[model samples]
Target: MGLVTIEKAHVASELLVLKSKLESEGVICYLRNEYTTQIMNYLPSFEVELQVSELDLEKVREIMTRKDAE
Candidate 1:
């Protein structure tokens, strides 16, 4: 399945939390550039990306939107 990024976090800890939240909701999530970001924390442009199957893109976005509202 093709993957699509759903969220980005500058901090590794925040990325971890987001990943955990998505997985808890039964969404298969992945962290892209996680280790790279951690190793190159000085680079502001290098942020961790949370990704999921393209089919789950809309669902993930909706969940994140509702989370932000709360």
Candidate 2:
């Protein structure tokens, strides 16, 4: 399947959790933060990215719904 963005500008932690949830549900996922690495190592980093998939779009949405309810 080709990659397609399902959500954009999502928080890093949330994105990571979302990735795990999608994986658990058997949906392949990818988080692309192509510009968030411009940070000082001694300081904090805040970044966001586009979450994606071509096959897992519906499954990703489904997991998001469940996570929102929790």
Candidate 3:
């Protein structure tokens, strides 16, 4: 299955919470370059990306939207 990026965050902690939420919903989330971004914090271009299977893209977006509304 192909993966699609759902979100990008500069703070790992923020992404961790979102990752946990996605995992709890069985979306099988992935954090791309999580450690690398953390290590390269000095670089503004380096941000952690939250990704999931392309099949889960819609659901992930819905979840994020709900979370943002809260």
**Candidates 1 and 3: which is better by lDDT?**
3
Q: Where is model 1 more than 4 Å wrong at Cα?
A: none
Q: What is candidate 1's lDDT per residue for 1-70, written digit by digit as tens? A: 6999877888767877778878888989988998998899999999888889998888888888878898
Candidates' RMSD to native: 1.6, 4.3, 1.5
- Model 2, range 1-47, lDDT digits (tens) per residue? 67887655434565666677777888877666634533432334434
Highest-lDDT candidate? 3
lDDT of 1 at 49: 86
Lowest-sum lDDT 10-residue window in model 3: 6-15
CA lDDT of each candidate? 0.85, 0.64, 0.88
Considering lDDT, which of the candidate structures 1 and 2 is the better prediction for this target? Answer: 1
* Runs off by more than 4 Å, candidate 2: 9-11, 34-47
The TM-score of predicted model 3 comes to 0.83
**Which one wins by TM-score: 1 or 3?**
3
Give the per-residue lDDT digits (tens) of candidate 3, residues 1-70. Answer: 8998878988777788889999998889888988998788999898888889999988998988999999
Better of 2 and 3 by lDDT: 3
Q: Who wins the TM-score comparison?
A: 3
